[model samples]
Target: MLQSVELASTSADVLIMAAAVSDWKPSDVSQQKIKKDG
Candidate 1:
Protein backbone atom coordinates (compact mmCIF):
# COMPACT_ATOMS: atom_id res chain seq x y z
CA MET A 1 0.00 0.00 0.00
CA LEU A 2 0.97 3.68 -0.44
CA GLN A 3 0.31 6.77 1.60
CA SER A 4 1.01 10.49 1.48
CA VAL A 5 0.91 12.81 4.49
CA GLU A 6 2.47 15.87 6.05
CA LEU A 7 5.86 15.09 7.59
CA ALA A 8 5.92 17.72 10.34
CA SER A 9 2.88 16.57 12.37
CA THR A 10 4.07 12.91 12.38
CA SER A 11 6.10 11.37 15.20
CA ALA A 12 9.63 10.05 14.71
CA ASP A 13 8.60 6.38 14.62
CA VAL A 14 5.77 7.04 12.22
CA LEU A 15 8.08 9.02 9.98
CA ILE A 16 10.60 6.19 10.18
CA MET A 17 8.04 3.67 9.02
CA ALA A 18 6.97 5.98 6.24
CA ALA A 19 10.57 6.39 5.15
CA ALA A 20 11.27 2.64 5.30
CA VAL A 21 8.09 1.68 3.51
CA SER A 22 8.71 0.29 0.04
CA ASP A 23 6.82 1.00 -3.15
CA TRP A 24 7.30 0.98 -6.91
CA LYS A 25 8.18 4.58 -7.81
CA PRO A 26 9.15 5.72 -11.24
CA SER A 27 12.88 5.62 -12.00
CA ASP A 28 12.70 9.11 -13.50
CA VAL A 29 10.55 12.18 -13.01
CA SER A 30 10.33 14.99 -15.55
CA GLN A 31 11.11 18.53 -14.45
CA GLN A 32 8.95 20.05 -17.21
CA LYS A 33 6.22 19.01 -19.61
CA ILE A 34 7.36 16.75 -22.40
CA LYS A 35 7.02 18.05 -25.93
CA LYS A 36 6.91 16.17 -29.22
CA ASP A 37 9.48 18.24 -31.04
CA GLY A 38 10.39 16.42 -34.22
Candidate 2:
Protein backbone atom coordinates (compact mmCIF):
# COMPACT_ATOMS: atom_id res chain seq x y z
CA MET A 1 0.00 0.00 0.00
CA LEU A 2 1.08 3.54 -0.74
CA GLN A 3 -0.07 6.83 0.74
CA SER A 4 0.84 10.45 0.19
CA VAL A 5 -0.10 13.43 2.30
CA GLU A 6 0.82 17.11 2.56
CA LEU A 7 2.44 17.00 5.98
CA ALA A 8 2.47 20.69 6.65
CA SER A 9 0.83 20.88 10.05
CA THR A 10 -0.72 17.56 10.79
CA SER A 11 -0.25 14.69 13.20
CA ALA A 12 -0.26 11.05 12.19
CA ASP A 13 -0.88 7.86 14.10
CA VAL A 14 0.16 4.47 12.83
CA LEU A 15 -0.82 1.07 14.09
CA ILE A 16 1.52 -1.88 13.81
CA MET A 17 0.36 -5.45 13.84
CA ALA A 18 3.00 -7.95 12.75
CA ALA A 19 3.70 -6.22 9.46
CA ALA A 20 6.35 -4.13 7.74
CA VAL A 21 5.84 -0.50 6.86
CA SER A 22 8.16 0.98 4.28
CA ASP A 23 7.81 4.75 4.15
CA TRP A 24 9.25 6.60 1.19
CA LYS A 25 8.81 10.38 1.18
CA PRO A 26 10.56 13.08 -0.77
CA SER A 27 12.72 15.47 1.18
CA ASP A 28 11.17 18.46 -0.47
CA VAL A 29 8.54 19.13 -3.14
CA SER A 30 8.64 22.13 -5.43
CA GLN A 31 5.72 24.47 -4.97
CA GLN A 32 6.07 26.28 -8.29
CA LYS A 33 7.30 24.02 -11.02
CA ILE A 34 6.16 23.51 -14.61
CA LYS A 35 4.47 20.22 -15.11
CA LYS A 36 4.15 20.07 -18.87
CA ASP A 37 6.06 21.09 -21.96
CA GLY A 38 4.59 21.80 -25.37
Candidate 3:
Protein backbone atom coordinates (compact mmCIF):
# COMPACT_ATOMS: atom_id res chain seq x y z
CA MET A 1 0.00 0.00 0.00
CA LEU A 2 1.90 3.00 -1.29
CA GLN A 3 -0.34 5.98 -1.68
CA SER A 4 0.12 9.35 -3.40
CA VAL A 5 -1.58 9.75 -6.71
CA GLU A 6 -2.33 12.24 -9.48
CA LEU A 7 -0.22 12.39 -12.56
CA ALA A 8 -3.23 13.24 -14.64
CA SER A 9 -5.23 10.62 -12.77
CA THR A 10 -2.95 7.70 -13.63
CA SER A 11 -4.04 7.16 -17.25
CA ALA A 12 -7.74 7.29 -16.35
CA ASP A 13 -8.82 4.04 -14.77
CA VAL A 14 -9.87 5.77 -11.68
CA LEU A 15 -9.65 5.27 -7.94
CA ILE A 16 -8.61 8.69 -6.83
CA MET A 17 -7.50 10.17 -3.51
CA ALA A 18 -6.08 13.54 -2.47
CA ALA A 19 -4.29 15.49 0.30
CA ALA A 20 -0.61 14.61 0.10
CA VAL A 21 0.62 17.97 1.31
CA SER A 22 4.20 17.47 0.43
CA ASP A 23 7.64 18.34 1.53
CA TRP A 24 8.38 14.64 1.41
CA LYS A 25 9.46 14.78 5.02
CA PRO A 26 12.56 16.86 4.91
CA SER A 27 14.08 18.21 8.11
CA ASP A 28 17.71 18.49 7.02
CA VAL A 29 18.32 14.91 5.96
CA SER A 30 21.93 14.14 5.22
CA GLN A 31 23.91 11.14 4.13
CA GLN A 32 26.40 13.14 2.05
CA LYS A 33 26.49 16.78 3.03
CA ILE A 34 26.73 19.23 5.93
CA LYS A 35 30.29 18.56 7.01
CA LYS A 36 32.52 20.55 9.30
CA ASP A 37 35.08 18.22 10.76
CA GLY A 38 38.72 19.17 10.56
Candidate 4:
Protein backbone atom coordinates (compact mmCIF):
# COMPACT_ATOMS: atom_id res chain seq x y z
CA MET A 1 0.00 0.00 0.00
CA LEU A 2 2.81 2.40 0.86
CA GLN A 3 4.56 1.60 -2.45
CA SER A 4 1.37 2.34 -4.38
CA VAL A 5 0.94 5.69 -2.62
CA GLU A 6 4.52 6.67 -3.28
CA LEU A 7 4.33 5.83 -7.02
CA ALA A 8 1.01 7.68 -7.38
CA SER A 9 2.27 10.81 -5.61
CA THR A 10 5.11 11.20 -8.14
CA SER A 11 2.79 11.64 -11.15
CA ALA A 12 -0.31 13.00 -9.43
CA ASP A 13 -0.82 16.78 -9.53
CA VAL A 14 -2.80 16.71 -6.29
CA LEU A 15 -2.74 13.85 -3.82
CA ILE A 16 -5.84 13.63 -1.67
CA MET A 17 -5.53 11.04 1.05
CA ALA A 18 -8.97 9.88 2.17
CA ALA A 19 -7.87 6.78 4.04
CA ALA A 20 -9.11 6.24 7.57
CA VAL A 21 -6.79 5.50 10.49
CA SER A 22 -7.45 2.51 12.72
CA ASP A 23 -7.54 3.23 16.44
CA TRP A 24 -7.03 -0.37 17.53
CA LYS A 25 -5.28 -3.52 16.32
CA PRO A 26 -6.63 -7.07 16.40
CA SER A 27 -5.11 -9.44 18.94
CA ASP A 28 -5.46 -12.50 16.74
CA VAL A 29 -6.25 -13.34 13.12
CA SER A 30 -7.58 -16.63 11.69
CA GLN A 31 -5.29 -18.39 9.25
CA GLN A 32 -8.12 -20.30 7.59
CA LYS A 33 -11.59 -19.20 6.58
CA ILE A 34 -14.24 -19.75 9.24
CA LYS A 35 -17.17 -21.86 8.22
CA LYS A 36 -20.67 -20.52 8.86
CA ASP A 37 -23.52 -22.91 9.74
CA GLY A 38 -26.99 -21.88 8.73
lDDT by candidate, in order shown: 0.58, 0.52, 0.66, 0.82
Using TM-score as the measure, which candidate wins?
Answer: 4
Worst 10 residues of 1 by lDDT: 12-21
Candidate 3 lDDT by residue in tens digits, 6-37: 55656787675565779368887889878699
| Runs off by more than 4 Å, candidate 2 | 1-22, 34-38
- The lDDT leader among the candidates is 4
Candidate 1 structure quality by residue, lDDT tens digits, 1-38: 33344545365455444343465576898999989998
Note each model's CA RMSD in angstroms: 9.4, 13.8, 8.5, 9.4
Please, what are the lDDT tens digits per residue for candidate 4 over residues 1-38?
99989987998799886745685566898899979999
1 or 3: which has the higher TM-score?
Answer: 1
Model 2 agreement with the true structure over 1-38: per-residue lDDT tens digits: 32434353246575433534545566787789848978
Note the residue pairs that clash in candidate 3.
none
Q: Alpha carbon lDDT of residue 30, candidate 4?
A: 89
| Model 1 quality (TM-score) | 0.25
Candidates, ranked, TM-score: 4, 1, 2, 3
**TM-score, every prediction:** 0.25, 0.22, 0.18, 0.41
Whole-model lDDT, model 2: 0.52
- Which model is ahead, 3 or 4, in terms of TM-score? 4
